[model samples]
Target: METKKLLKAAAGAMIVAFAISACQTKKTATGQNADPAHNSMNSVDWAGTYQGTLPCADCPGIRYTITLKDDDTYVLKTRYLEKGDSVFTESGTFAWDENGGKITLADRGEKFQVGENKLFHLDMEGNRITGSLAEHYVLTKMTDQITDRYWKLIEVGGQAVADGSTQKEPYIQLNSEGNRVEATGGCNGMGGTYELKEPNRISFSQLIGTLMACENMEVENGLKRALESADSYHVQGDTLQLFRARMAPLAKFVAKGK
Candidate 1:
C-alpha cells in the first residue's frame, strides 16, 4: 500500500509540472502575436504643422492650425473667418492614448486621431466624426520646407511693407510640382521657375509678369530685384529671408495663416 501511495504522488507532481509548462508556452505564443511595432506613435512621421478649416454653425468656418512637436507638446491657433483678424492661440502638452493612435489635448480635452500626414478630428468621446461633414474634419500636414505655402511679403529692401500700399497683399507661393513659383507684388501677377540646389542655395529663372502698372510699383520693383539677386535663402519657423551672397537679406516673408 505504501509503495502505491508513493507512485500516485509522483504521477500527480509530473502532471502539475506539465500543466505549468503548457501554460507558459501558451503565454509566450500570445505575446509573440501582439504587434506593438505597427502603431502610429512608432510608425508614423507625425510631427509637424497641420491645418484645416473646421465647420462652425454660427460662423463661416474656423481656421485651425496645430503644430505638434516631437517632445509631445502642441500649439493650436484658430481664427474665425469674417469675424475678426484676432487669432486665438493655445499651447499645451498632449498625451497619446493607450493604443498609440490618438492624442488628447491636455488643456481642453480635445482629441485627434493621428494618421499618416493627417489628423482626424475626434468627437468628445474620442471617436472619429461621422457623416457628410466627416471629410471636412481632416487636417493636412504642412511641409517643413519653403514649399506649397502662401508666403506674404512683409519686408523688402530692408523696409516694412505698409498696409494698403497695394491693391492686394504681396505674396508668393512655391509649388512643389515642377518647381514653379507664383507671386503677386500686391499688384501685377508674376510667375517663374525656381531651383533649389544644395541645402540653402536658390535661384529663380524664366521670370515673367503682367505689364499692368499700379499706383505703388515700389514694392513690386523691389521684389523683382530681390528675386533676381537672391543666391541663398533661410527659413526660420514661419519667416523666410532671401539673401544675396553674404549681404543683408534682400526680402523677408512670413508664411500666411501660420
Candidate 2:
C-alpha cells in the first residue's frame, strides 16, 4: 500500500512541474527567452502616419510611410525613389516593447523606437543604431489641423443655392499665417480675420466687403450677417460649417481643391 501511494504522489508532482514549465516563456538554443512576453500595449497613444526619406544602401532612398491604427494594426508603404515609383506595402499586427518605448513588427523581425510624433527605425537585433545616416532614419508625424486654403460657400443653415440665381457665388477662405479670411458676400468681394477662442469656437474680425449696389444685396447681406454671428466651425469631409453659439451652422463652405 505504501509503495502504491508513493508512486501516485510522484506522478502528481511530475504533472504539476510539467504544467508550470509549459506556462513559461519559449527558450532558444542559448536558453534565453526568444519571444517578448511583455504586453506593453498601453505604452503610447500613437495612431497616425509617419513619413520620411530613409537612407538606403543600394537604392538612392526609401520613402517610408507607416500608419498605425487604433486597433494595433499597422500599414507600411515603402517607395524606392531611385528604383522607380513602385511602392511595396506590408501590413500586420504590432506589439509594444517591454520597456514601452518601442514597437516590434511580429511578421517582419523589425522594431522601431516610438516617440512623440516620430519613429526611429531599429536594427534586426533590436539594438541602438550606429551609422552616419542614423539621423535621417527618423520619420515625422502628419498634421491633422485644417489646411489653410479657400473653401467656397456651398450652403447656409441647411439652404443650398437656388438654380439660375443672378447672384454670384459666395465663398470664404481662412488665412494660413494669420487669423484672417478673404470672402465674397454673394456679389461683393470681402476679406477679414478670424480668432479661435476655444477648442471648437471661432469669431470673425474686421469683416469689410465691396460696397457695390446690386439686386443680390439680400443674398449678400444674409451671408455677411452669418459670418459676423458665427461662433464655431466644424469640418466634415470637404465641407466646412461655421456655427453660432448654441445654434445650428450659420454658413457652410466646400473646399475647391486643386
- Candidate 1's C-alpha runs over 4 A off are 1-144
Q: Please, what is the TM-score per model?
A: 0.50, 0.44
Clashing pairs in 2: 179-194, 180-193, 181-192
How many residue-pair clashes does candidate 2 contain? 3
**Can you write out model 1's per-residue Cα lDDT over 33-105, one digit (the tens) per residue?**
3346777899999988898999999999998878888999887878888897677878889999876789999
Error of 2 at 74 (Å): 29
lDDT (Cα atoms) of all candidates against the true structure? 0.87, 0.73
Q: Candidate 2 lDDT, tens digit per residue, 107-167? A: 8867888877888888887765877878888888765333355677766656775634526
The per-prediction tally of clashing pairs is 0, 3
lDDT of 1 at 133: 97
Deviation from truth (RMSD, Å), model 2: 13.5
lDDT of 2 at 87: 66
| Decoy 2 TM-score against native | 0.44
Q: List the residue pairs that clash in candidate 1.
A: none
